[model samples]
Target: MQMSWHRRMLAAATVAAALSISALWVAPAQPSARNGTYFYMVMYRGGRASGPVESEMTLTCFPEGGNHPDPGGACMALREVGGDFGRLKIAHADCTMEYSPVTIKVLGKWRDQRIKFIRIYPNRCLVAAMSDWVLNFP
Candidate 1:
């Protein structure tokens, strides 16, 4: 009788262990589980109504590579500016002072934090001069 009781207890323990392992496999993925930051960025002439020249594409940083054409360059640019568009370092260029505006809209997650940003540039060249090709999709 004692031997049978011991066998039952062992069987219950085995079942519990199997259930625990299955639960782990079925658990939902957390945001932090992602490889890196993800963003959907749009570069358009004038306003959003003007239509995106580069539509919206996924951009990732820190081991970068997404839909963005130059992932490595874009990630490096963001790192240089510490992910702050307003703080982008202007590159030396002979940019005209003439105003023909271009706008950029970035909306997505960065470092697991939600983000929405917008900036306007005098022209495409001026945008290119700042933050390298961070704004240039292709």
Candidate 2:
């Protein structure tokens, strides 16, 4: 059976649309929390996720590795509070009158638990002030 050109084009279009829709429905794979390895993707942006990204890094703990410069220091900071960001101690820092707001986002699995954190700081200085070093991705 010979198919017309128009019919072949229609079939291709349908397949393309189906693939696009399915891609939208697909979710990324989540890491297991029992591996004793904590991985976090940290992002610093001018606003929300849609905003321009200023800095980003991959931080992995429990072996203290990843693209992060001071992964050991960063992991130590997290360990101080048992991977609890809320309990992190903030250090004092000086800054100018600049008002560049930086939005930080963290997502990962931490020691048998899932971690998702997001906060907007008035400037980069405040993020540096956080002794936790979790948000200090450079």
Clashes in predicted model 1: 0
| Reference-based lDDT, residue 97, model 1 | 87
Give RMSD to native, each candidate. Answer: 9.4, 6.2
8-111, model 2: which lDDT tens digit per residue?
A: 99999999999998987896543334465566654556767546778877777877777887888888888888877767788766767588878777777778
Model 1 is weakest, by summed lDDT over 10 consecutive residues, at: 28-37
What would the per-residue lDDT of candidate 1 be over residues 31-122, giving only the tens digit for each residue? 22375477777778785535747456777777676778888887787777667766767777777888878788887666666777888878
Task: Please list the residue runs of candidate 2 whose C-alpha ends up more than 4 Å from where it truly belongs after superposition.
Answer: 1-36
Best by TM-score: 2
Q: State residue 106's C-alpha deviation in candidate 2, in Å.
A: 0.3
Each candidate's TM vs. the true structure? 0.61, 0.67
Candidate 1 Cα errors over 4 Å, as ranges = 1-33, 48-55
- Model 1's alpha-carbon lDDT is 0.72
